[model samples]
Structures are given as structure tokens and as C-alpha cells.
Target chain A: MTAAALSLSKIVAGHDGHVSISDVTLAVPAGARVAVIGANGAGKSTLLKTIAGELPPLGGQMRRCATCARMGYLPQSATVDTRFPVSVYEFVAMGVWNHVGLFRRLGPAVRQRIDAALDRTGLAALARRPIGALSGGQLQRARFARLMLQDAALLLLDEPFAGVDRPTREALMALIDGWHAEGRTCLVVLHDLDLVRQRFEWCLSVDDGHAQLTPTAELLALRPTADGAAAARHAFLRDALRA
Target chain B: MSWLLDPFDFAFMRGALAACVALSLGAAPVGVFMLLRRMSLMGDAISHAILPGAALGYLAAGLSLGAMTLGGVAAGVLVALAAGLVARRSALREDASLAAFYLISLAIGVLLVSLKSRNIDLLHVLFGSVLSLDRDALLLIAGIATASLFGLAALYRPLVIECADPDYLRQAGGPGALVHLGFLLLAVLNLVAGFHALGTLMAVGIMVLPAASARLLCERLDSMLALAVGNALAGSIGGLLLSYHLDVPAGPAVVLSLGLIYVVVLAFTALRPRPILTSEVTA
Candidate 1:
């Protein structure tokens, strides 16, 4: 078997000793476009954060191939404070800090890469504006621009399409498709099951603090039937009407 | 020209002006970071916390600059660390813990002052004698300003990244904790330096007010920094002149001048008509 891009065995992850996901064992093949799906508060984000090394696993063994050394993570948009006085260009330039480190000058080549990333993400013209002033979609695009500059072998996205419009979502999905074509490993946390089935080959279903990894078709088959889904929709509408 | 040149005619006046300029240059930039981080009151708390240390130094070695600065830095760092610990370990929020610690520190400082020092010395500690600054005080202010400028330059990128998104910085392998502690140390250093000219009670006034005023006028970070420093310098010069002519206290005069600038800026912006839709086409 080809070496797995990422492998986690019996992992327990969360913050401050409160484990959100427990006993998660899975291995993702290299170049797989995997979708992580679950209801709200199901620890999907916690799993992604652990894989990205943002949160340490309480108990687990995680191994990554040498080719997957460079990993990029895009946290949910709500986690960033847009009120800070950073320009789009300056914020995107931070993606290069891992390579350049502190005190290294942004030479011509680095500047070119930053500019190219901004241009590709459609943020070149708004480069000088403060991030606080940008709309939500624009800010998400700027974040994508920063991710483009990362140029990682593995990418982890948490709610990447949350609160985004259709065109912007399509544009972002196209970028991910390009990354997939280049054989980069991607694990995306998403809510739309249809989109996941359409785009991803594998699915990791997280529910009740456990994760089940399966092919997308198999996972879709395990989802609730049409009558159950309709009942869930009706219950949701009733709650909304009562509110 | 005479109005400008007259303040420098006397050695004492020149020394006072130099002290003000040095304090402004060093403390204002740190103040900008404090404002951006929404820790403006933390500066106030640390300034108060310095008082007990200064009092201890006075008790040990009377009116010694090195001793008092050392004492103040130690006390400030202790309070910061303790408050941070309490906030992290307990249910109390950081600001609430800071308030509690600083109040206790202030009471202790006052008790220490009453126990050992005379009223004349207490007055000096409460309100600095800017016009009577000796060469030692002048050197201390200049040295701190120079060091702080270099320190800020070195920590600028990490500090900004940490403020923007600390988790992202950590994921990118930047030293977030080191940058945070270094920034706190710099803040304490600048506050100690300001105490020589503005005194512990009023030192934070000089640091925060000028930065606050500049925020209303400038939109970019670099511009805001430059404007804050400029506003501080202007307030210092204007306050010194006012104290000379009107015979008011110099420290409050300087801080009040900054406050006046803020009010004026507020009024000016309020009167100006705002644009309805300022968004422009990008590309």
C-alpha cells in the first residue's frame, strides 16, 4: 500500500481535558479529497484542529508521510477578529513567515509570490484596505489568498464555505479542485451533504464523539431515509416558527 | 521664534522638554499596541503597581534612580504574572484580576510611603518635578526610549501576528509566548521611564491619551504611530509652555493638553458629513 498521507490511531482530542472526539482511528490515502461531516458540536472542527497541530491530542499516535510535511490550515472565519488594523496584503504576507522566519527581508521573489496569490484570489485591488472594512465574502477570499501563498502538501479547512455566497463558494471550490488535481491532500469540514458527495471520494462522519471513515457512496447510503429527512426538516421549521 | 526659543533658554526648561520628548517617543508606541490589544487599562494597572516598588527602593536607598527602576520593574512584572496566573487558574477574567492586584499594590505603596518618607518626597512621587530633572533622570529617560524603540522593531512582526491571530501564529511556528512576555516587559520598562517625568499616577496618562487621540485621526498603523508620537510631542511642548505662563502643574498640564486634543478631534469629526457609500471598485 502507498504510504498514508495522515494516520491517527485511538486519538482523543479537545481543549482543557474535555474530550470532544475520542477513539478516532483512521488513515487517509495521499491525494484524497475527504469530506468531514457531522451535526453541530460533533467535534469535526476539533478533529481538524488536532490534525493541523493546533490542538494537541490528549491520547493518540499520529503519523504523517514525509511528503505531507507542509500542512496549511484555514480556521473558521468567526475565529478571526476583523477589527484589527491589518491590510489585506500585509495579512496575506504572513503566510510566508514560516519559510522566511522573522527578520528576513521580503525580497523581490517573495513579493512576487504575494502579489500573485493576491491576484489569483481576486484580492489584488483591495490589497491596501484594512481587513475590518472588507465584507465577509471579501475577507474569505483574502483568507484563500493567504492559503494560496502557503503552498502546502496537505490542506485542512474548517467551515470554508460557511456564510459565503454561491459565486464565491464556486470560486473557492474551483481552487480546491485545482489543488486536488495537483495531488495535494485535502480534508474539508462541511455541512452540505450533496456538495460532499459530488466533490469528495471519501467521507469521515463524526457523530456522538465518534468518527467513522468510509467512502462517500457508503456514507451517503448510511444517511437518514427520505421520510426521516423530511420529518427532520419539518421539526426544524416548527422550531423556527415557534421562535 | 521667541515663543519657541524662550522655553530652551533656561537649562531646567530644556531638561524638562527633553524629558517629555523622550517619554513620548518611547511610551506612545507601546501605548498604540496597548490600545490595539484593548489593554489600555492594563497600562494604568502596571503604572500603579510600580508605585510599591518605587516606595521600596526609596526605603532602601533614598531617591536612587537605578534602585527605584529596578524595584518598579520587579514589582510590575510580579503583578502582571500574578494577575495572569489568577485569571488562567481561577474563574476571574484577566481585567478583573488586574484591577484587584493593582488596588492592593496601590494601598501597599501608600502605606509604605506614609511609614518611611516625608510629605515633600511623597509629593514628588505623586507629582514629578519635571522642571527640576537632574542629569541622571534625563539619561534614564533617553536610554529607555532608545532601548524600547529597538525592542519594538525586533518584536513588530510577531507582535502584530499574535494580536491578529495568535493560533495562526502558533501554527506557523512563531514564538507567541515569548513575544507576549517581551511586550509586557517593554510596557513595564516604558512605564518606569515615564514615572521619572510624569510620576506613577500620571505616567500612564501620557502613554494612553496621545495614542487615543491619534487613533481618531489616522487609519494606518504606521501613520497612527507617527501621529501618536507627534501628538505626544506637541502636548508635551504645549503643556510646558502653559505651566510656565499659567503656573499650573506640568504633568497634569501635559495630560490635559492631550485630552483637549482628543475632544477637539472628536468634535471636528462629528461635525464633518460622512459619506453614505464609500466602497470603491477594486480592479
Candidate 2:
């Protein structure tokens, strides 16, 4: 088996110390495209944030292996204030921050990389436009272009496709495929089971305060059956109260 | 041309003009960032917070510009840091904590001035004596402006990211919160510098009014900054001339000129709306 890119050991993660997901111990192998899926409010974002270091895990340890040098995180779109007066190209170039950092001029090579990323994401034509002028789909495309320039070893995406149109979603997914082929690990929080099954090799299902990681097919098979749905609901309520 | 050129012939009028222009160069850009971050009123809060320190400085050194400036910067920064800490550590929101701190500072500042200084000195401290700016005050104002311009340039990229998409900056390992704190410090520094010319009560008006007016006329950030500085210059020159010719107080006259510009910009935009009003509705 390939070495793990990231691993969580008996983790309890949540927002502001409120335990939303607990007892999640999983090893995400390098270059794995893992789909994180669950019911609404099942701590998918919480888990990704813990991994992205946005929020500390309440209980356990999360370790990135030697190969995982950098992490790129795409938060939910609502968190961004797009009206703050930056051009699309300028916004996309921000992804180079990890390498160039504060005060380092962007060399010609970095500029070329940014241009290529924008072209690949279909944002080159809109590069001079302010970020606020872009439609929802175009904004998502711009974000993907920025992510491409991040050049990180591991990627964490939180509901990247939430408000995106179908074409933009497919384009973003294709970008994800490109990243995976480049040997980058991706932990994507998604609601579309069809897309998850079609694209993802690994799955992490967060449910009722527990997170289970397995192969996509196996996890889908193990989902609550129609007859067990009611019992699962009752158990979820019990867990929620306990939490 | 003579009416305009006549004002510069007098050394004190020239000095007041230089002080106002220098103040505009520094404080206007800081105001633009604050406006972008939706912290326009925070400028007001910090201005009020500068009062007690200036009063304390007056009580100690008796109207020495350097002493008052040092005291004002310290007080503004202290109030900002204290409010930020309270908001983070406790349940009180930043606005509430800032309000509480600034109110107390304002009250203490007034009491301090009334206790020791003559009524005329209190008037000078509150409204400022722009026409009476000496060489030392001019040097201090010019020096602060130079430092502020350089500081804004250095902090530009991170400050933009912190304002636009702070979460992305944080996740990208760019120290967003620290950048924000640094920005607040810059703003406090500029406010202290501004208080020397415009007085604590009206210092923020010079910063905020021009920036707010500029926002109405431009969609691009650079354009907005240029327009804001331009507006501040025009208002400074116009208000100084108004004070000289009409025998009015210079600080209020300067701020009123800025306010008039804002009203004119507002009226112009209202009559002929732009196709792209980027500041209108945001994500």
C-alpha cells in the first residue's frame, strides 16, 4: 500500500470545543481522492477544518506524513467578501503567497504559472475584471485557478460545488482529477453521491458523531437501508443529545 | 489665480496647508482600508480614544507637539488592543468593547483638560490651532506622512487579502489576524498624527469623509485612493483659504469642506448612476 499522506488518530473535532464528530481515526493514502459525504450538518466541514488546521481537533492527533509539505484549503464561498476591489488576475495570483510570501516579487516564471492556471480554469478572459463582477460559476472557476497555483501536496475543499452550476462543477471536478493525477491528496466535502461514486476511490462518511473511512463502494453499501432509516434517525437524535 | 496664490504668501497659512495636505496623504489611505473593512466607525472610536492621552500629555508638557503625539499614539493603540482582546477572550463583541473604552477615554480626557488648563487652552486642544502650526509641528506632520506612505506600501498585499478574503489568507498560512492587527496599528498611528492638525474631535473626519466621497465616484481601488487624496487636498486648500479670509476656525472648516465634497459626490452619483456600482451590493 502507498504511504499515508495524512492520518487522524482517534480524533474528536468540532467548532469552539463543541464536539460534532468524534472517534474518527483514518489514514488517507498519498494521491487518494477521498470523497467526504454525510447527512446535513454531519461535521464534514469540521473534519476538513481540523485537517486544514483552521480548527484544532478537540481530542486526538492529525499528522501529515513527510511527503505532505504544503496544504491548500478552499473554504465555503460564503466566507469570502468578493466586493473588496481586486481584479480576477490579482486575486488568482494570491495563491503564490506560500512560495513568494510577503515582499518577494513575483518572478516571470510565477507570473507565467498564474497565467497558465487562469487559462486552464477558463478565467483568462475575465482576468482583468474585478472579482465582484464575476457570476457565481465564474467565481468558483477563479477559485479553482487560484487553487491550481497553490501547488500544495494536500488539498482540502469545503462544499466547493455548493452554488456552482453543473458546467462549473464538472470543470472543477476535472481540475481535481488533474491534481490527483499529479499525486496530490484531495479531501473533498461533497453532497453529490453520484459524483462521489463516479470519481472517488476512497470515501469518508461522517454520521451520528462517528466518521468511517472505507472504499467508496463499500461505504455506499453500508449506508442505512430503507428499513433501518428510522432506527438510524433515533440513534442520531440520541447522539446529538449526548453531544 | 491671485486669490488662490495669495494664501501661500503668508508663512503660517503655508504651514497650515502643508500640515493638512500631509495629514490627508497619510490618513486618507488608512481611511480607505477602514472603509473597505466596514470599520468606518472604528475610526471614530479610535479618535475619541486619543483624547485622554493628549490631555495627559498637555497636563504634563503643556502643548508640546511631540509629547502630545506620543501620548495619543499610545492611548489609541492601547484602546484598540484592549478592545480586540476583550472581544476575543470574552463574550463582548468588538464594537461594544470599543464603545465602552472610547467613551471612558473621552470622559476622562475632558475632565483632565477642565481640571488644569485655561478655557482658551481647552479650546485649542479640542478644535486645534491650525493657523498657528510652527516649524516643529510641520516637521512632525511631514515625517508621519512619509512613514505612513511607506508603511501602506509594505502592508498593501497582505492588507488587501485580509480585507477581501480573510479566510483564504488564514488558510494559505499568511497570518491574516496579525496583518489585521498591524493595519489597526497603522490606523491608530495616522489618527494620532491627524489629531495634531484636526484635533481629536474632528481628526477622523479628515480621514473618513474624503474616502467615503471617493468610493462614490470610482470602482477601482487605486482610482478610489487617488480621488480620496485629491479630495482631501482640495478641501484642505479651500478650507484653509476660507478660514483665512472669513476668519473662521481652520479644523472645522477643513472637515466641512470634505463633508461638502461628499454631499456633492453623493448628489452627482444619484443624478447619473454608474453602470457598475461595485460598492452597492457585495458577496
Candidate 3:
């Protein structure tokens, strides 16, 4: 009933003369943590891509808030090589690239934003390291750091926890929770339905090219939160950085 | 060292040296990027396709160097365009088009030479008798070599990105087509200048070997070019002297020298522990 922060109307997307996902429509209100769940290839990825403007929707319209200056989309795989000769700070600074054209210097406010992004993502200490040397978890965190810098009200993440360790996954989810507390809307495509139920308040399940809305409590019935209290140390470091 | 000086006493030896230097320096960076982009084999294909063009140019204007070089460049560009077209239009892959173009060009070149000039100089075409390089050829190749470096400097950023991932450029709304065209044109120019000293097949080898060797040694794009250019210069000079003493073909000698450098550097890289590991840059 609320004005959706993001809306997609009759989206059709495909490859090579066949539709991968078609007739998909959805809307999300502000500050909603929406999870797209499906068995593989339910067009969950395609739907996210179409929404992010990475792929042109074959026959539909999609809209995001004009005031949403910060929009973050993390793809299923890393977009660029961390191996290329660039540093983490330089790499995250690139997230602000659309904000600053190539040839302009980063003034202090921009500098502060970048420093904050790194610190929020728990990457402040590793800022000086070359990107290529980072571990998988660290690399994902660095990318997350960049998204935080964008400060967008809408976030689209395609399987952020895939291939990460369980503890690292929990840490990342905690960070996402922190972002949610800040009142930013998020749409994350995820496989782990347990985390979907426990952390996310809303769920959209996709099957056979169609998605059905499900209550967050129903998904939570399968696996409730294991530890009621968050990991004390991880939460402390995360919260302390906010001050 | 004395033997190197002895060869320099002859004017033909000096011409041979000049051709070697021109081909080596000019073609190395072009070759470096080509190899980096997984298009090293394409370099071989482009050079082969230039032969018939050179042959046709000779047929039209006799043995005039300009006509031959111009014809070769036009043909090379045509081959590049054709390969691009074929890849885009059909499911036929890039390697397939490259192979087809090179084979067709080689056959046509042979047939054209046989038809137009029965007395086509084998020495001039194959081994690259650098002794035959005229003052005008020297000036032209030198000019082309200079242009190649300047062009590289100007287009460095776009070309690097193109090699790394063209999809990024497409997303950025930049003119991906223009970048592709510019690189093909640069390739044609390099091949044209390379035609003088290394002829067709060997000239590409002259360009590619040094670049490949440099790639193995350097960790970054800038360092790779620097090493490649330096390696090319060294290969040219060393090959020139070796050819003079052994009375061999200058082009093949230069290519062999470059090949030797690649093998040596590869061995060195294999022997050394990876340096970037212990020096892990934490970000």
C-alpha cells in the first residue's frame, strides 16, 4: 500500500530469441529487505539485472526513486579483476567514479565518504593493500565497502553470501542488517532460505518464471535463528565503528 | 664486439641493421598488447594476409616500394575487416576466420607472384635481404615506426581497457566500435612497416617474440611495453651482426634471436619464486 521505493512493470528478459524470464512484475516499499528465492535459473538473476539497468527489459518499465543518489548492485561474480595493479582504496574510490569524472581530484568530503565506506565495511586497516592480494572474504568486503560509499537508498545484491565461509557470511549479514537499520531498502537474491527467514522480513519466491510472495515467518519455521544474541565480538566491532 | 664493428664497415650491413631496429621497436608494443589480449596468433594471421597485398602492389607499379607497401597495408586492413565481419555475422569463431584469411592470402600471394613476375626475388621476400633496403625504404619504415609509438601513447588507456574487457566499455556508453577500428588500423600500419625487414611471416615473429618474452618478465602493462621495446632493439642489433657474420637472412636471424630471448626469460621466470606473494599488499 505504501509508495514502492522501486517498481517493475511487466518485465521480459531473455537471450537468443527465447525468454529467460518474462511477465515479471514487482514493487518494494522503502526500507524493505526483499529476498528473491528460487531453485536455480528461475530468472531471479535476470530480474535483478533488468532492475539494475544492466540488461534492457524486453517489454516492460522499471522505476527507482529519483532521489536515490546511492544505488548499489553486486553481481553474481566480481565485475573487474582485483589482480590488476590497483589498490583497495583506489578500487573503492572507483565506486564513486560516476560521481567524479576521471580527471577530477577527490576533495576532503569525498575523501571522508571513502574513509567511512571502508571503515563501515571493516576494511579500513587493509586500505593500503593491492586488491590482488586480498582473500575472497576480504574482496567481497571491499566491494561492499564501495557500495556503502555510494550511500544509495536502494541496494540490489545477487547472491552475496555464495562461496563465503559460514562465519564470514554471518558477519556480512550483520553488516546488511546494520544497513537495514539505517532505513535503506535492499533486494538480495539468496539461496539460503534460513537466513532469508531470520534476517529478511519479506520474501519473494520465484519458480517457473513466476514469483509468489511469501510471509517471512513461514520461511523462518524451517530454521529459526541459531543464536539469539549476535556474535558479541563481531557485533561490538561493527557497532563501535558507528560511534 | 670487433666482429660487430667489422660488419658495420659495409653499407649493406648498415641498411640491414637499420631495418632490424625499425621493425623491432615499432612492432613490439603492438605485439605485446596483441599477446596480452590473447590475439598473438592473430598477429601471425594478419602478417600472412599482407603478403598478397604486397604482391599485388608490386604487380601494379612494378618494384616501387611505396606501391608495394601501400598495397600490403590495404590488403592487411581488408583481411582484418573481413575476419571481423565473418566473426560477427556467423557462428564461425575468431580463430576460424583468422585461419581462413591467412591461408587464402598465402595461396593468392603465391599465385599472384607466379602470374605477375616469374623472377620474384626469393631473397627479398623470404629471408629479407636487408642489403636491398634503399634510402627511401629506410626513411619510410623509420617514419612509420615513430608514428606507431606516438599512436600507442595517445590511445593507451582505451586500448588497455579494450584488451582487458570490452564489456566495460559497452556499459560506459563509450564508442567501442571506434576503439576496435583504431586497433585494427594500428595493426595494419605495424604490419606494413614490418613487411620491409621480416617480410610477411617472419616480420610478425619479430614483433611477437620480444613482446611475448617481455610479458613473461613484467607484471604490469606499462612494464611489459618497456621491456618489449628494449628487447626488440636488442634483438635487432644482435640479429643484424649474426646475419652478417654467418651470411644468413637478416629477418630470420632477428626472429631467432627474439625467440632465444623468450626462452631465456621464460626459464628465468620459472626459476624464480613469485615475488608478489610475500609482498602481499594489504588494502
Residue lDDT tens for model 2, A131-242 = 8888877888888888889899999898899987788899899999999999999999987767877899987778888886778666445443313343363344335434
Query: Can you write out model 1's per-residue Cα lDDT over B32-151, one digit (the tens) per residue?
Result: 988888878888889999999989998899889888989999998888788889999999999999899889988998888889878877777777778889999999999999999999
DockQ of each: 0.35, 0.46, 0.14
lDDT tens readout by residue for model 3, B1-283: 6876888888887887787677667778888877766777777788888888888887888888988888888898898888879989999999998999989998898777667665547446655556678899888888888898888766665565555444544444345678678777777888878877677767687678888888777656677888998899887788887887897777788888888888999999999897664125432
Model 3 CA deviation exceeding 4 Å by range: A1-5, A29-33, A64-73, A78-155, A170-186, A212-243, B9-19, B64-67, B84-93, B118-123, B126-131, B162-166, B172-177, B273-283
The alpha-carbon RMSD over the true interface for every model, in angstroms, is 4.0, 4.1, 4.9
Which prediction has the highest DockQ against the true structure? 2
Cα misplacement distance, residue A36 of candidate 2 (Å): 0.5
Report the C-alpha displacement of residue A153, candidate 3, in angstroms.
6.8
In the range A1-243, model 3's lDDT, one tens digit per residue, is 666788768878765656777776777888888888766777788878777777877888878876544577787887565445456787677666456543457889899999988887778887877666777888888878767766778888899988787777877898789889998988899877557766888876666666555457654543344334323322332233234
TM-score of each model, in listed order? 0.93, 0.93, 0.79
Candidate 2 DockQ score?
0.46
Compare candidates 1 and 3 on TM-score and give the better one.
1
Candidate 1 pairs with clashing backbones: none
